[model samples]
Target chain A: MTYTEQLNAFYKMVSDECVQGVSLDCVIFGFHDTRLKVLLLRWKGTHEWCLPGGFIYKTESVDVAAERVLRERTGLDQLFLQQFHLFGDAVRYNREDTWQRQKMPMPFESRGWPERTLSIGYYAVVDQTKVMPTADFMTDECRWWEVSDLPSLLYDHRHIVEVALQTLRLQLSWQPIGLNLMPEKFTIPELQRLYEAVLGRSLDARNFHKKIMGLHILTRLDERRTGKAHKSPYLYQFDRENYKKALISGNLSFV
Target chain B: MTYTEQLNAFYKMVSDECVQGVSLDCVIFGFHDTRLKVLLLRWKGTHEWCLPGGFIYKTESVDVAAERVLRERTGLDQLFLQQFHLFGDAVRYNREDTWQRQKMPMPFESRGWPERTLSIGYYAVVDQTKVMPTADFMTDECRWWEVSDLPSLLYDHRHIVEVALQTLRLQLSWQPIGLNLMPEKFTIPELQRLYEAVLGRSLDARNFHKKIMGLHILTRLDERRTGKAHKSPYLYQFDRENYKKALISGNLSFV
Candidate 1:
């Protein structure tokens, strides 16, 4: 089907089976090459990029809807998704110029939709090696962009991304990071790099190592990383039982 | 106006000026008499109680709408309100028995509202002494109920309260509690009781005092509480500068 045909079918589905005026945006975080990356989509007929988002169906809860969107885009399920904030600014969806730039019909105005729409923002951390990024009918590209160097996002999505990162950084003080992003057996420096990426700053290596060790959630392996040039560092992996206990207690501190 | 007339006017106002299917609920919390309390409203002409909530106007943001609701209900402003979660279950508002129990009209069915309504949940901490609780047209009584001994709430409101309290307790690890709940000058035991109230558990007195002092957000006041038969304890006030810094950095760990 053509772009216009696909959009028609999408809008028809939205009208027939989805709840109006309620949507959700996902700021998917993945750690790759010592940098935090976010998943974004480029509109099918335009260069404009936005966070992967979708409308809530009338039958499913908002969380279920978010999980479905994640599964559709990443080909993965139950990937540590959390609701962070609700973006309900009056003019969040009032972007006519975006449509004109894409040369596509305005979805809301044509359908006599509500003047104000609200979006629930959710952030997910996923394993980059396991993801098969797929674009839906409305977008031509689905890929990861480094958080530090992102394109001009559509609507208030940039603000959404900023808040998601802020929430993630604050969450670091209470929850362990890189459980999904780290390899099963990795060096301490690898995990530290993931924390630095999310925090957008470097940390003193000795201090970070001490703090993480004191948390008692990691299990140091007998072997080293093996491929390093000089003094190879010991490998560590999350002790699943301790990690689960810390998650439920929410007492892991890493500042 | 009569109750039926008030209902008609509220529905008309919602249709004319508010965004349909999007609302907000505020879990107003106050610390009093060594207990954590939540502000709830008793529905007019019914025994049912629920969290104080209101609709969002098309011209306002959700936060602003929440503030408006708080101000209208408490007759006060500038409370420490934080958005914790969004409740968007498909059947969250589908309780037909509630209206049947009230022997009143089902407003949504009468007005053809959306099948799924999403509510943004915000929890606020306020000084109980300063509030002048007031009821709106739909409610006849506004009062605080001890969190441990709350009445059966309407719809899914009991679940909302549970989630709000859980979020508040989790946040206690990263943020200082009792900034709004405590008096200007308080003893360490007084503040510790406030923390216990929110966490629903006890902390060792020496451990809590040591941990709170280590955060460096309080100033040891020379003044002591008078009019006590026992040895009076010294009072301490939160140092605003340090509290502000800790809040921004989010590194204050109490657990």
Candidate 2:
């Protein structure tokens, strides 16, 4: 069966169950115009925008739940998603009076459960162009917001975001940072913007390029951007196999 | 009303009505007699030993459940316990069965509604001398086993212990180690044994001393061990303020 069928079957099985459970929320990070932005969804009945999230089934593994959430929200599975933290505050159960409640069916509203709900926070960085993320948009709208100045989120979501950010920072130092968040083929500037968004600071362009190119995780491609001016920047794609090997060997560090 | 009453009330109320859900299993690590070991418990009416674990309450945080399990098995609450990994395999649901297949109990040996059971793993290093392990020995028997030659465990518990071991190895590179698992005041060799246990290998003793002593997280306690046959080694304890400052500054990489 297809992924959609599997999801539909899962939803059919547990739509009205009253048992205690879990959901996966993705703080999908992306780079747009040199800024790091996160994907947030508006509710159908409320105006508040929150991170993209999905409920879990009794039969599903927690890792699979995270992958499914990533797939449902972005139409992109096998992306660089991670399970960084689990948020389980008892008060977070009452969604109607909390973060989900604030979402109005306006420009930025939420369409979530009306009962006791608990969730785990899974986050990912995807190449903005690779994701067709108008997913699950009913009366609710979806859009990206800058990381530095995030709109208030529901419940302890802000705290969840903080944990994700901390995990991202630590991971960056150990793993190659930009490849997961960017497209398969991209210019050096695109890679630079992704890092800038994540690090929330500017980096010396020449030095950043020198450091990244030195790692040899990328291979220069033949293609160039179509709708651009100035010298047509050359595109480079991640050397996947070598990068995986380098990752295991600790040759990649975010710093 | 005390915590036990509140917890017992919560447990009894949810036993029939709700999915009391997760259990927290601890894979506590220790360095003893030049070997690495983990704390284990053997359930009553069973011949095998397993990780000491218990259920989480509807209202209490998962971390609290782990702490309660630690206290229940070993009578240690104030030890250094950290959330290492979460095990949520679907195969884990038939866990009680794996524990009692051979004329033990019905589920492990009877019949009941299938309940989903995921577990969170926590590990702590404590002064074993202070712990008064379970006295009744009814539900289970508790003891510490050397990690190098661990007996096959119930369900995915052995996998859970492996995860804890990996987390400990990762923590060794950056976080302050040896202190919590050791006596308040210990010699340089004590710290070395811990590093070796966690890394599962040997290191140059002089280099290990240079690396640790260079960090300066230790306070030279004016004491020495009387029972040792070798030269009287100077004892040391963690400098609380220095440790806190190191944690805040994100300088705690040890692996």
Quality class of the docking in candidate 2, CAPRI style? acceptable
Q: What TM-score does prediction 2 earn?
A: 0.86
lDDT of 1 at A191: 89
Please report the interface RMSD of model 2 to 1 decimal. 2.6
> Which lDDT tens digits does candidate 2 get at residues A91-127?
5544456633763222111222223344677779888
lDDT (tens digit, per residue) of candidate 1 on B2-111 = 77887887888886788877778999999999899999999887888989999988888888899999999898787789888999887875467767655575556576
TM-score of candidate 1 versus the correct structure, residues matched by position: 0.89
* lDDT score for residue A146 of model 2: 81
| TM (chain A) per model | 0.94, 0.80
True contacts kept of 1: 0.70
Question: Tens-digit lDDT track for model 1 on A18-111?
Answer: 8777789999999889999999999877888999999888878999999999999999896789999998887775477766655676565576
